[model samples]
Target chain A: MTGLPMVVSAANLPARVRIHEVGARDGLQNEKTTVPTEVKAEFVRRLADAGLTTIEATSFVHPKWVPQLADAEQLFPLIADLRGVHLPVLVPNERGLDRALSLSATRVAVFASATESFAKANLNRTVDEALAMFEPVLARAKAEGVHVRGYLSMCFGDPWEGEVPVPQVVRVCKALLDMGCDELSLGDTIGVATPGHVTALLTALEEAGIPAAAVGVHFHDTYGQALANTYAALEHGVTTIDASAGGLGGCPYAKSATGNLATEDLVWMLQGLGIDTGVDLGRLVATSAWMAGQLGRPSPSRTVRALSHKEQ
Target chain B: MTGLPMVVSAANLPARVRIHEVGARDGLQNEKTTVPTEVKAEFVRRLADAGLTTIEATSFVHPKWVPQLADAEQLFPLIADLRGVHLPVLVPNERGLDRALSLSATRVAVFASATESFAKANLNRTVDEALAMFEPVLARAKAEGVHVRGYLSMCFGDPWEGEVPVPQVVRVCKALLDMGCDELSLGDTIGVATPGHVTALLTALEEAGIPAAAVGVHFHDTYGQALANTYAALEHGVTTIDASAGGLGGCPYAKSATGNLATEDLVWMLQGLGIDTGVDLGRLVATSAWMAGQLGRPSPSRTVRALSHKEQ
Candidate 1:
C-alpha cells in the first residue's frame, strides 16, 4: 500500500552507523554487462547525492583480471570532484596501490582470505602468502597517509572448505590489523553464516584486542541471513556495514549467487530502528531504480521495488 | 558454493522450535489463480511428510470472501487421515466454525485485528465487536475439546495508520488469551517492524503475564525484515514460527506484497543454529520447488532457489 517503513527504535545499537557503499565496484563486477565509464561515474555521484559518504568507486585490478572496471582510471577522475565523500578503491597489490595513488585516491582496501582455499583460488596464493603480498601495499598506504581497509573473505565459510574455524579467522584478522592496515571488514563471501558464528568471530576478534569499532561487516544475502547477521553485528557494537545499492552485485536467481546485501534494505532496517546512517531513503531508492533500468532488470531490493512501483 | 548453511549454534535459544506451516492457507489465499482441491490436499500431505507438524490447511470462510479456498470442505477430508499432524483451519464466525466442526477438525483459528482500521476493513466490525463475535466460537470450540489459536493482525504497522502502539496490541492479545484461545500468533501484516519493536512488544506481553511460551510470531517480508525480526523473537524465547512453503502467499515482485516468511529460509537459520526442527531440508526444498512449478513461478525463498538450482 505504501513505500516507507515505520520507524521503531531498537536498543543497544550504535547511535549512528557508517555504511560503506560498494555498489559501483563489487556490484558491477558480478554483473553480466560492463557498465559505461560515464554511467559508472554518474552512479558514484548519485550515491553521494543519496548521502552515502564512503562510496567504493572502483577496483584498481589488472585489466585481464577485472575487464569490467578497466576504466578505473577514467571513472575515478570523474567522481574525484565530489566533495564530502570518501572514495575507496580496491587495491589488489603494490601495483594496484600505485594505480590508486596515481589517481589521488585517498582511501584503498586490500582483500585477504580467512581460509586457505579462498586465498589460493582468488589470489593464487596461500593465506600467509597473500598476507605477505598485502604487507607492502598496506605499508605503502600507511606511509602515504591514506586510509586503508583490509577485507577478509570467507570469514564464516569457504566453498572448498565448508566452515572456517573461528580461531583460524581470528589469526588472520589479527595479522591484518597488526600490520599497517587501519581497519578490517569481515566477509561472509558464501553467506553460510548464522548469528552465532558472527558473534563467535566478533568475540574472538575482541579477545584478540580488535575492537568491533575497527571492523565492518560484509554479508551476502545468499541464504537470506545477511540482515539477521547485520543485526547481530550491530548488537556486538559494529559501526560499519558494507552494502550494494539495489543489491547489484549478484542476481539471486543465478545458481552462483554473489548477492551482496541491498543498501536500501539495510537503510530501511536502520531507519526503523532509529539508528542514523545519514542516508536519504527516497534518493537512495530513486538511484537504485534508475540503475536497475540501466541494467535492464528490476532492482532486487524489496524496498526499491515497493516504493518505485507506487510512484509508477 | 553449496546449498546448505554451516551449522553454528548461538546460546540462550530454545532447543527446538515448532513451525506452524501456513503454505496451504495463508500462502495460496493471495494467489492470483486458485489452486484445485486435490492439489491443496497434496500440498498438505507433502508438508506433513516434510516434517511440519502444524499445518494451516484452509479457511472455512464463505466462497464470496475467499474464492481461492472455497473447497475447504472437500479439501479437509482428503488429508484428515494423515496421522500425527494438526491441520488448523481458519473459522471466521459461527458458520465457518460449524463447517470445520463437521469435518471433525480438531484445531481452528479465529482472526482478529489489533488496529481499528484493519478490524473495520477485514471483519466489517470494530475491535471489540470482532472479539465479541469470536466469544461464541471460542466457547463452542472449547466445548468440543478443540484447540483454538487467536491471530492478532496488524500488530506492528498498518497501511492507513502508520505505527501501532505496543499497549494496544498487548491489550488485544490478553483479551484473546483470557477469553479461551490457548495461544496467540502476532501478525506483522505490513512487515514494517524492527527488532527493537519486536523485543518491546514481547517484553510488554510478558509484563502482562503472557509467557513467551504461549505465543508465536507471524512475520511478512514486505520490506525484507522478516528473518531479522524472527531472530529477535527467538532471542526473546519464542518457540513457534508461522511460515509458508515456497513463500506462497505474496509475490515479492508484486507491488502489494503479502509475503509470508519462507519456511525453507527459517529452516536454514534454525538448522544452522543447531536447533532441532525435525525438517528435512532436501525434501522441503523439493516440495517448494514442486509447488513453485504448480504455481507457474519460482518460489521467493532464497534457500529454496539456491538449493534447487544445485540439484538441477
Candidate 2:
C-alpha cells in the first residue's frame, strides 16, 4: 500500500480509497422484512468475492430493537472464514459487545447521534447518554484486541432539528475519537448534506484535531448529493467512504432517507477518476442486480440500472 | 446579479450559474408517448414561473425524425410572449431554421456529433457531413441576428467507438465555436464521463483558447455522475448547466442514457452551496411532480423523489 503513489492535490485526488461496505448491517437494519440468515450470509460472501475488503456484517442489537438482524449470531459464523476481508458488526452496548466477542468477532462498531432529537428517537437516550453507553463497549473491545469503529449519525441535519452545526458535529466526533475507537464514520443519516456542508464539517473536524485520515463519510442519496458530497470529501483528502451494495437501506426514522450511496456508483466514479478501489465493478453490479431480484425491486442505483439495462 | 458577492476561488466556487432548462425540447424528445402541445407549452411556462430564465421550448426537426416535437411550430407562438424568459428552439437545417424565423424565435440550437457512429445512426450522415448540413442553418440564423447554441454530442464516449479521445472532442467543439455559435454545450450523451474526464476536457478546452464562459455542460445521469461532473465543471470555473425538469429525456441512440440531469437536482446542490441560480427549489420540485403525474410515471430524480415523498 505504501509503494503506490499518493496524489493529494486538488487537481489530482488520492490514488486509492477504502470503500467501507455497509450493506449487510446498515443497509438491512432499516429494512422492514427480515432477510433469511442464509441469504444474509451469502450476501456478505458475494460482496467479499467482488473484491470488497471491508464488509459490515450485522448488528448484535436485541431483536426487539432491530428485528431484521435478529439472526446475527447465526449469520456471523457463515462468512467469518472469508479470506482477506474485515467483517465488522455493530455493537451498541456492552451486552452487544459480549455477543460479538462470543462469536470471536475481529472488528466491531458503535454508533452515536450528534443531534439530540436523533439520539432521543433512535437510541432512546440523550447525546451524552449515548456516548456514555458506548464508553464501556469501546473499552472492552480495545481490551480484547478488537478493532472498533465509531459512527456519528445526523452529522449534517436532523429531522426534528434542521441543520446541524459543524462545531456541534465536530464536538461529538472528537468525543468518539477520544474514546479509543480506531476510526469515526460521519453519517448524513437524513441524507440532507450538500457539498458545502460536507466541506464545512470536514474543515471543522480538521480544526478540532480530527484528521481526515481518521474520518470516513457515510452519505445517503435522499437528495442525490451523495456522490457530489463524496467528491467534496475527496478533495478535502478523505480516502475512506461508506457505501451499500445495490444502494440498499433507508432510514425508517426519515422516510426520505432513501438509500446509501451505492457501492457500484462510487466504484464507477473512482474508477473513472483513476483511483484504485480494488473492486470489480461488473461483478458488483451483477451482485446488486441479483440482490434486487431477491428484494423484489429494482436497485435504486443509476449505475446498476444502466449496466443491467445494457446487458439486456 | 451585481449586488451578489462573487466568489471565485478553488475552495469557494462561482457565486452564480446559468441553468439552461431543456425539459420542453430535450426532455420530452425521447418519450414514447407524445406529450400534447398545450402541455408542453405549460411545462415551459411552469419552469419559467419557477424562476428559470432560459428554457428550450421545442425542436423544429422534421416530424418524422422527432415526432414528439412535431408541434414545435404551434408551440412557439403560445409561449413567445413569456416575460423575462429566453425561449430557444432546436433547428436542424435551413428548413427548420426557416420555421424558427417565421415565429420570430430569438434563440436557436443546432446539434453535431463528436463520434462518427452516433452521427451515422442518429443523423444519417458522417460527422463532417452533419456539420456541413448545419452550416447553412447557422449562417442564416446569424444573418438574422438570432442567438445560436451548438450542441456537441458524444463528447465523453461513443457506444461503438468507446472512450472518446479529448483531442477529438476538442476539435469538434472548436469547430462549433468557430462557426459563430454564441455558446457550446458539451454533452456526455451516454453519461459515461467522470469528474477527472470532465476536468481534463475543460482544461483541454482552456488550452485550446475557448473560455469557460462559452462552454456549458449537459450531462446525463445514467451513471449518477451528473452532479459530481457539474461540481468538477464549476471548480474549473464553468457555470452554465443544461438540465431538464423532472429529469426528463432518455437517449434514443444510447440505451444507457436513462435521464438528463434534473433541474431540481442541480438547483438543490447550487442552493446548498450558496450559488445564486435565482431558482425557487420548492417550486421546481412541485413542477417536476406535476410533470411526473402527467407523464404517468414517477420522476427518476432523487431530489424530486425525496422532496415529494417528504410532503406525503
Q: Please write out the lDDT profile of model 2 over residues A1-312, one tens digit for every residue.
A: 111111112364888899999988988886666789999988999999999999999999999989999999899999989999999999989999999999999999999999999999989999999999999888889999999999999988777877777789988988998889899999988777778888888888898888899999999888788999999999998999999998888532332547899898898888888788999888898888888777776777778878888788
Give the range where candidate 1 chain B is weakest over 10 consecutive residues by summed lDDT: B249-258
Q: For candidate 1, write residues B1-312 as lDDT tens digits.
A: 556777778889899999999999999998877888998888899899999999999999999999999999899999999999999999999999999999999999999999999999999999999999999999999999999999999999988887889999999999999899998999998888889889989999999999999999999987788999999999999999999988898775575455999999899899888889989888898998898888888788888887888787
Candidate 2 chain B, run of 10 with poorest lDDT: B1-10
TM-score of 1: 0.98
Docking class of 1: medium
- For residues B1-312, write the lDDT of model 2, one tens digit per residue: 111111212365888999999988899987767888888888888899999999999999999989999998889988998999999899888998999999999999999999999999989999989888988888888999999999999998887888788899999888887778999999988888888888888999999999899999999888888999999999889989999987888532233557899888788788778888989888888898898788877777777877888777
Q: Which stretches of candidate 1 lie over 4 Å from their true place?
A: A1-3, A255-257, B255-257
Error of 2 at B228 (Å): 0.4
By DockQ, the best candidate is 1
Against the native chain B, each candidate's TM-score is 0.98, 0.94
Query: Residue A265, candidate 1: how far off, in angstroms?
Result: 1.1
Quote model 2's iRMS: 7.5
Q: Candidate 2 regions off by >4 Å?
A: A1-10, A250-257, B1-10, B250-257
